[model samples]
Target chain A: MIPNTMKLFVGILRPEKFQLILASGIKYFAPPKNYDDIEIPERQRLRIYDKVPLYPSNLKPPKMQKRLRYMRGPELLHNKLQLKQYGVMATGGGRLRHEHFEMVRLQVARRLDMKRMFAIWRVDPPWQPVTKKGQGQRMGGGKGAIDHYVTPVKAGRIIFEVSGKCEYKEVYDMLRIIAERLPFKAIPVSQDIMEKMAADEKWQEENNLNKYTLKYIIQNNMGGCHRFISKYDHKWYGKYV
Target chain B: MSFIKKGLLQSPVPLMVAKRFRGKINVQKPRKPHFEKQLLIDISKPYYGPPKNSLPEITLCENINKKSYKREIDNPFERILAKECLDWFNTSKMVVFLHVNSISMEDKTPVFAALKKNDMHLRTYGKKIVSMATKGTRYEVINQLFTSHQNIIFGQPENAGKMFKILRKAPQLVVMGGIVEDRLISKNDLVEYSKLPSLDIVRSQLCSVLQSAGSCLVGQLNQNQQMLVSHLEKHIEIQNNPTNSDNLDTNAKSES
Candidate 1:
């Protein structure tokens, strides 16, 4: 059925799934004709990566996602004003394409967010060791990194993760199942805006944090775009956007 | 269980990001379908004496015909960059280490094609690759590719069943990773499980192999893992594997 301009909400999915979550109606494990098969509807992919409150000591990422949802939605929506959703994925690196499936985007991001949502699911990278010579303090170890469990990306929001051997859909479905089961709060967004954010690149640019001034989702101006980087490191703090 | 303005329950697993509305947003161009393929990223460990090769790594471009090159995208690109330096590695007459991940839900063909292209050796850990922990059929593709290689080692204890499928081709692919260390960290369960840091895991795996084929502390592994490795059939045996036992014992001694 052709869709109407219905304001919508969104979320990410968990990576693992129960044996029989879907009765089989939902699409699963279909081969793609090419890379174009993936898409994160311009609107649905309306997320701006920023380093807000890194952790939830007093403020957490969920709360941050919620607050940021409110802050960016209306303007981002350009007053069409719909809902938006944010899902996090635990990709050590950010590389999902601009056009992966909307479902996959939500699912993958939410799967990564699972570590942040629930501490039990917190799976740290298996090889990053602390070099600071301490029990807990690390070169990358900060209460923010641990408490937030996820680093916000600046420009990586465009790159869909292609790492490892999992198929895009398969990986997405697993996250969808998890999102279905996650207990984390769903921060409501303007469905209208969330629906159109990506397509409106010009408007996106208008709202887009100035490249030199504002740091973006996992965006790194340092030499090249690095992961887990921060505009917080820059001498011109909050001045670039 | 904190509820303030709305009725949002904070469970261990939150399902709030639900989209009861599947309304079709204006999709620009329809997404092109893609399948997962197996890729054998063969990196001959740096053991062939000094650094004879000019380039340390070779990354296959997204397009195969293109000469594989490398540029720091500010972080580790494509997860495993070892594939970039395959040329220098294979010809070096060195021990190649392939860190493999397989998921039952993926299509593992591309990875296989890449590995076969390099004419690389293969091995397994005799364990199951975690389908849940991975992204796509790509995991399965890698699984099938190496298992069918001329030399295969079943590194994953869980995937021991897949060992024969590989043994039928390759003589013996060296097997290591958590499988050798006896810890299987599935991505599915990693949401909350303990894993060595990514850097530490990478360092240990590479260092373990490079540092004198000796026993090493394998990725935050524990006593239980040690026992499991000791019992992996080949590690034991009073006769058929005496030489193997001697080396393993020496390594185990160092880890302790």
Candidate 2:
């Protein structure tokens, strides 16, 4: 059957050249990858996050201080990956506004292959209320009204996690776009990448040639440095504000 | 005189202007530096030396050649598997390490079955098991081949030729390197080794060469004595026939 088709094409191309076409059928195809263990969750897409927390109408909204400590220092609890997959982690501290949350959701939803992959939030939705004065309000006013809400994120905090049958390369671009757009420094990391980063940090600490570390100096109060540094600096060794 | 001039010049100009216009003002002030601050700066300077507890460099590139399958060795099963690997390493005269690329189940089954038929057993041990078994042993050099997916084929040295023949059919299993007769051999050396004659045949050939050398030496040692005996026989013959000796003399002179 192919020879008859080849005869027609002979005027345009040689029949011997078509021999490779027939030979192409004998290719050794690699075995299909096994995804038997991948149990995709019912919700294969990122869940929608609330723009604002539902507060009781009768109660007056509570005002709070700057409480910058919430966004300072490294995240100790949520620093590790729970799902053991790919995610975006903050390298510095900042607030995640409701707009940033929506932006991340939209980007992930648009790029995610929902059939094989699912994304889950690691950080909570916007809950911390940020107050601001009106544009032309007088400075003598007692206090400003609650303007908007934000989620305080700290260094080493994993923003969100993506897991399922997909690989790190598949979700890296989506995570990277989110990381780059965040108000603070952030990076995309997979499980192994995160593990390696931790290992490298441990290795550096173990192999540090300098005998005097920041922790060592603060602990010993060398040169009465405690008088110059803040209490937070004493706690975090000036690693964070 | 300076006080009189100050009182006289207390005229129209303001006190600020008078102070600004003052001439020959003293500019120098006493310096009281903070020695503690200087001490802090001195201590802040980084002094680097070798770490007190220096360890091996952390690296991933060094183990890239071998595809490793890492497994925890704390389990009792892993210990048994490690022991088995040690036994395989010690008992087998030929141990061939192969890098297994992705091969379909159909292809892999046949290749494994063929190897099994030739009395060659193929084993796949995790990197942890291999390290545990090969540590402090001569087979430790082969630990480099445990990087990724590796198959170790164990058999007698004489069956190396058959193993190579069966392995040739499956291109997915690349022959990396192996130990043949307690000696490490590369891929090319393995091929050469497989082509070599069997041990019995080589032993017979060596015996034949030795026997031939002995016979040649015996022949060489008897050559001068045999020539001398032939000359004595010729002299006896010459005495027995003097008339014949004269004719023989003329022939011997011509021959000489």
Please tell me which predicted candidate would have the highest lDDT against the true structure: 2
Deviation in Å, model 2, residue B63 alpha carbon? 12
> How far out, in Å, is residue B217 in model 1?
99
Which pairs of residues have clashing backbones in candidate 2? B66-B147, B66-B148, B67-B147, B67-B148, B68-B147, B68-B148
Against the hidden true structure, what lDDT does model 1 obtain?
0.32
Q: Which regions of candidate 1 fall more than 4 Å away from where they truly are? A: A1-125, A131-171, A177-202, A207-241, B1-256
Q: Please give the distance, in angstroms, between residue B228's alpha carbon in candidate 2 and its true position after superposition.
A: 49
Stretch of 10 with least lDDT, candidate 1 chain B: B36-45
Per-residue alpha-carbon lDDT of candidate 1 for residues B150-193, written as tens digits (9 for 90 to 100): 22322323233233244224323223322223233332232222
lDDT of 1 at A67: 17
Per-residue lDDT tens digits for candidate 2, residues B1-256, read: 8998788866766655433322221112212325653455455545455554574565425776778977622556656778999999999999999887777779988888998998899887767679888999988888887764468999998888898889888999899888988999898999999998988999999999999999999999999999999999998987899988789789999999
Question: Residue A90 of candidate 2: its Cα lDDT?
Answer: 95
State the TM-score of the second chain for every model: 0.16, 0.61
Instruction: Give a tens-digit lDDT track for model 2, residues A178-218.
Output: 99998888999999999999898888777667677777887
The candidates' DockQ values read 0.01, 0.07
For every candidate, what is the interface RMSD in angstroms? Answer: 23.8, 13.9
